[model samples]
Target: MESRSKAHVSWCILLEITVAVLFCSNAQAAPLKITLDTYRNCIDGSILSFSVSCCPGVELDLNVTVVDFIPKRDRLSGHRIRKALQCLTGEELRTYTEKLTRAYELMRALPSSDPRSLHQQELTHCAHGTGSFVQDGLKADSNFTLDIHSSWIFLPWHRMFIYFHERILQKLLDDPTFTLHFWNFDNGLDGRTSSTEGCSEPGHFFPGIYNDNSTSTFEPSRSNRTRVLNVPIDLTFPVMFSEADPAVALRCVNEAVPRNREAMHLAMQKGRVSRDFFGIPFRYGDVRPPMLVGGGSLEYFPHNSLHDWVGGFMRTPLRATGDPVFYPAHANVDRLWDVWMKLGDGRELLQPTDPDWLDAEFLLWDENRVLRRLKVKDVLNIADLGYSYEKVYDASWIFWQNSTGLVSSAMAPTQP
Candidate 1:
């Protein structure tokens, strides 16, 4: 009788554990899938939307080829990994700028109906980012919608977007080796010598390549304050200055470096976890309530703030990508994603394991004007996409010492 009772108790415990596991699995939402029918207008005022479809109607056909991402190692060995350079002054910058401007001039000249055209490229951001889609079975006019921003989707989605955008430029330039460089706006340590040769210097100022009025990279709608020479980009952004007042703006600009360093440190520190860094899960069938604050630390700061700082078209998602400076700006945001994972030796950092996140899919037009489907898991590593960023003085903020002269144990400044 005693043996039988023990057996029954063990069996009951096993059943309970099994049930719990099944329940947890069922609670997770399915992976997101894009369809022509999924498009919608903005459900709230936080992000603007257009009444008309952002995507070109011709590209929405169900019949299209989708090339799955195969590992680069599995492919040909001679393919070069393009290196995206820093925005600082150098011979490299001059060459990159020339190629970039020429490519854009060609891209902009393409008919607006072409998927690779500048207009359509801007619409891609609107379609995916500005509440242009929603969950299945919901009314197009409903108060719930889908946006690539404010969630784990932000990083991977933007990476793929820029990847295709760069590819289009490469096609136009007929140079597969051409790379899309980054605006290193976060590095506020101006005039400091970097430990690595040709790695970086003060890159906080607006990239001059984009400011040249004669180039295709120039956008007149940007803030005039940004054109001021030697005024570093304040990483802390809107919180640091008011453009409305000249005196306060100058004062804030003077104090930008130290404040920027602090902001970068705080953002990285706060984003230690996968959920915190990538943002809350936003899977299929999920209804994003207006109150949901899902943007990760990096996306919220530096990233979004920089968008606002650029002003004009950049301040609005519907028109942000229309500004020529948008691509390089997002390149830095993508670079930081890579940087975030390497922080703390990557022990404490954890990316989402959920299949819903890994398998989330998006549609984009390749350089050939052929529409392709890509998955988040496929772009987890930039190297797989055949690109890498030039090393910069990333340590400036990673080991920053605060006003109190305190440094966290996890990140101690390297001894010179």
Candidate 2:
């Protein structure tokens, strides 16, 4: 009878363990939810409702606050920018590129589920939560390229990229509550500081805090102005060259060009320029020689330079790699343009005055098409595109009447 009791006890313990395992498995199977909102305030002085859609459950009405974002500070200063560039051994450069390539692949492979699909999933699972939207053909890799030439082309490409990414979040989560906030850097008016003295403010709408040491400065200019080969190469070069191995391209940047923090710090000197393929010189600013014009110099300088400048020289054919940062940098440039528009006398600049600029067309996509051509007049008013950014200078600050007005007006407001 004692032996029979011992066997029965052992069986009971085994049954308990199985039950515990099943319970834990069920707990781990919960679905994910996301939500996104705009930065503007509502009628109650709360954050404005940009849009709020969600996946899976009951949606709650909440006010989201929009604040200025800042990048982490870097300590390196002066000639460090040039020194860093020289320090980039070919091997280091290769590794850095590889990592960017991998990031591209991962972003591209994100599941192509829209808001409706997520909502249905939520109903089926009976999960309680909200999430952001997702969209089609909205992968991040499509924008990375050192080969981009015209500032006009570069700026719009990034703007569209940011818009598409935000739209994707809205589609996936169906939460219009989700909104993207940008870093305000004009004259540091918002009191938002950057980790790198030479680094410009981050632009485009990115969710969450990102602290990647991917910024570089090559002095004489506020940022490095490297000219890349303008000649287009076979779009399939990366794929074909690697025997269609995605790993090959990723390895090139990841292991070769590890992020160079010190070098990045050194790159932000005044009067620095980077040479691209065939040795074309590029610099920052709107001045005659393109002086360093960060922290708000004037519209005629860098603002005009952005539209007038073109990438020159072609040592070799250029191919696109999948690095997400490329688009953000250009987006930063566009944001600067937005700031410049507010600084000017609220008058539109005539592009037709410059023959070369007038003939140029910016290639981009509208909401319905793949590639659409736009002119200088098409994008001048970013607000028309359904977005308005917080001014670096508040209305309480002095209003500038001209480029020089930035200083004079700040000292004393122009009374009406």
Candidate 3:
């Protein structure tokens, strides 16, 4: 009997030791890097199912030096600002809209094969999101697929993607000072716009700049119901309106403002830690399963909700960047990351301090088509990225506390 008990104790110790070794191995994993031969899978297994090659075949200009991303402080015209689209008035609004339209026009005119062209940009998004690319220098039968979504890489990777896109637009315009504008979808409260700090009006509606059919910003494939009926975006999209008819959407629209506030409050309250706010770690050699829900509170909810609401090209990961609204929508997602960092109100919620996360890097083509490598640690500060968002009052949602235990879309309060 004593011998049997001793054997059980030895087995338990061995199991614990094995677990510790596995954890250490994962925690010490290396950062991911991309390569030219990295084949991005083009299979779209979603509702819009299709298969095509998304892999880029362009040969790198090896003669060109690969530059490390250094913030272009000179591009800041007394600090370059990404203003809320709703705030621009008169000449400011007209000029900004015209320039942005012209920039897209120029980008679309580029050859489809050009890495900086609009079509290639769409392909880039597919390569990053659809389990297309894998880690550098891996062998066949390896499962270390490289995707930017559903992990800690989501926020930083998207930020880097847009940064280069803005740069490309600036290059096409020959205007080094041009910056992108963002949609203020989170600020559902009305009177807060009158405040001297952030925006001039409520921005819950889709920005007018993207809706003009004649402009390059317009996308024809999006949902006509929201466009025609003019429904404000439902932040609780996954729960309430993925398949709702227009009547149901309008009914929910009437309650959108309060519900949006509640949704924001809940998303923020849930994001009180690094893993909860940023997402799970995806290190070198990590085999991230496809369609996993590894996104943090903000990424999982509002960021994705807006995408699903936009529908059409914006609906799927494979073709989202084809929609011009995708950029502004993602810009707002990037802005919300900044907002998350400051939500402490003195509590000091922080990002992950792990070296694996801080060291992860990706390759991108700059505005001039120069290849550049960027690291996660380099982009932690927006000011260092040479731009900042207009300050909108988020307090309406920030201070809101959920009283009812309303947890599901079905549980949302409705008025007769």
Clash count, one per candidate: 0, 68, 3
lDDT of each residue in 209-249, candidate 3, tens digit only: 99999999999988774475547887666533446444335
Where does candidate 3 clash, by residue pair?
Answer: 40-132, 41-132, 198-391
Q: Residues 1-416, candidate 2: write the lDDT tens digits.
A: 99899999989888888744422222322111112211011111100122223222233222332221111121111111101111223775455344333333333454323222212222211111010211111212212111122222233334544554433333333444333334221221122342322323222112112123342211111111122222111101121122344532221222211111111111111212111100121111111111111122222222222212211111111101112322233344456545433444422341122322223232322222222344433444554444544333221113312232222221210000
**lDDT per residue as tens, model 1, 1-416:** 99999999999999989844432223546987764455322223235223645645444343555555454643223344334344335776677778989998998899886889899888777766655566552454444466788778888999988888887888899987777778887876643454654455767778788889988988899888678876777654552234674532532445777777776776676455676677767777566523235667777677766776677778766788888789988998898888777775562347887889889887777887776667899899877777777777778788787652321211211000
Predicted model with the maximum TM-score:
3
Of candidate 3, the 10-residue stretch with the lowest lDDT total is: 407-416
lDDT ranking of the models: 3, 1, 2
Residue 9 displacement in candidate 3 (angstroms): 15
User: Positional deviation of 316 in candidate 3, in angstroms?
Assistant: 0.8
How do the predictions measure up, each by TM-score? 0.80, 0.30, 0.85
Q: Give the TM-score of candidate 2.
A: 0.30
Q: How displaced is residue 322 in candidate 1, in Å?
A: 0.9
